[model samples]
Target: MTMAWGRSAAVGVGAGAAGVVAMTLVEKLEQRITGRPDSYVPARTLERLLGLAHARGRRAWLHNLAMHASQGAMLGALRGVMAGAGLRGPWASLMFFAVRLTNDQTFENASGVGAPPWTWPRDELVVDLAHKAVYAFATGVVADALAVRWGPGPGQVHAEEFPGRRRHIGPPPRA
Candidate 1:
């Protein structure tokens, strides 16, 4: 039950993209209801990372879209790897949601394009978390589906072999 790293990553990319699409749709709806302006932190972060000058107007919008899509697709790879390891279901998606938030904070803060989550308004934080959760669970769904071709992951196998064992039972046998 070895993990197929390459295949998993490839599957993840696709899953991530799908997750981004789902998130975007949700964001759009939420924004329409709340009249929340689009956040351009992603575009700013991308510009800083690429040593490009700050953009405005339509250019900024394009940059934002590019960053949003690429980042989601890239993160989806992690979810795919999780699925490849048999970490499927809502629990796994919950974990991935944390990962997604961590990744965003890390990059956004490091680039000095965004403030810490604690500094954000309560409503803003909630909106952000909701969007990321959507991405995580959506990506998880895709990754879990794609990884089915590889059968149960090592973790699943281990769970079956040692349902309630408290002792270290060692790794599951190789397939």
Candidate 2:
């Protein structure tokens, strides 16, 4: 009856949605800035285009959603924790976002534009970074919301173990 892992699954779904939107917005922004239309689609949509759902049906959707959401949540959580820990600021934030932007290679490669050296590198980097940072932030927000119901907590038990068989009870009382 308990849906303990539901939170992570929900996070994946939300993250996938955000990924789709983020990719679209970035492509539009890039096109405007560079005056070139780049054939781009959201990351989540690409997975579907690649026939994820067609091949796996409900299980595929569930798997993709969970995987994407977890990745987004992890990135966001790291950024947040770093910021809160006083180990990061605007400069670090910029770098983090920039690092995430490199993930756009899939979109660019798909366009058949014949990648040119240093072609709009600065613009793409800037745009993708900003877009990804926002995507990461959005993913975190959704995860936090779901965490209220699904986040691991102080004394939560691992899903792999039965309550009574947990090591906390000293090796299940020697069976």
Candidate 3:
């Protein structure tokens, strides 16, 4: 049940891919209801970062998706590491929410394709938050589940080491 960093990272990327799929579905549903146009930040950010000219059609959407999906997968690896450290469940997800938001804003602002989040329209901000939360929670579910194989993380170990802490509920704790 010991944490394996390589395994955790690989599992995390898988979980993140799943999270991206879930987020896409949720976004599609919301778009249907709100008639919101697709956000172009991902594509724009990629284009700028790569020094590519703005794409006008399918290529633009393709760049957007590549950035979006790759970002989700990469971020998932970090979440996996968190799980390996015994950070799971809602609290872990909340921590991950901040990470995800920071990652997005950093890229967007750096690319000069987006304004500071505080300057965004309230509705736009809310929508972004909603999507990011979905990604975070979904990633948490998968990461946590995968981490179950590795047993409790470092945090869990520390907590369990408290005097009089419950033990012998199962096999020896790895964390």
Candidate 4:
């Protein structure tokens, strides 16, 4: 039987949390090397949602932290469900990368805190992609690990017509 969504989501939380942590560490390390200034998208989105103005000091840092972590955890749940359905490996990570990027852009654009991606400077774009890639692949690794307990998910099951995984079409094609 297929895994239930509830269970998938639960495992996803764990996976997502692990992914976020990894992503955070990577970002911190990269920041030291590249001397890149922090992007304010997460903090801006939080402020918009909370109906608060741009903040500074401990308050802004807290908001930024909360937004980053929460977003990662929630997105991880989505990736978890995907893995539960048999979407794993690089293919799944690619899809998840798109999802994560889209999620962030949607929030930023909708909140009017950011402009379209095409409008971003090349350097900013690269930095964003680098960070998101870490999160996407990290989430995929964790989700795949958790879902492995249940075996190849529902989609991996071969259809009836593909029985025994026969490779020769119509009795071997006489080659």
Which candidate number would show the highest TM-score if scored against the true structure?
1
lDDT of 4 at 88: 88
- How does candidate 4 score on lDDT? 0.86
After the best TM-score superposition of candidate 1, give how far the Cα of residue 17 lies from its true spot, in angstroms. 0.3
Q: Which of candidates 3 and 4 is the stronger one according to lDDT? A: 3
Query: lDDT scores for all predictions?
Result: 0.93, 0.47, 0.90, 0.86
Candidates sorted by TM-score, best first: 1, 3, 4, 2
Q: Give the TM-score of candidate 3.
A: 0.90
Candidate 2 Cα misplacement greater than 4 A, ranges: 1-3, 22-36, 41-120, 150-175
Candidate 4 at 155: error in angstroms? 0.4
**Please, what are the lDDT tens digits per residue for candidate 2 over residues 92-111?**
45554544454444433554
For candidate 1, the clash count comes to 1
Using lDDT, give the best candidate's number: 1
| 3-73: candidate 1 lDDT, tens digit per residue | 88888989999999999999999999999999999999999999988999999999999999999999999
Error of 3 at 58 (Å): 1.0
How well is each residue in 16-133 modelled by candidate 3, as lDDT tens digits?
Answer: 9989998999999999999999988899999999999998689999998999999999999999988888899999999999999999999889889988999989999999999999
What is the Å distance of residue 74 in model 1 from its true position?
0.7
69: Cα error in model 2, Å: 12
**Each candidate structure's count of clashing pairs:** 1, 2, 0, 0
**Of candidates 3 and 1, the better by TM-score:** 1
Residue pairs with backbone atoms closer than 3 Å in model 1 (clashes):
1-175
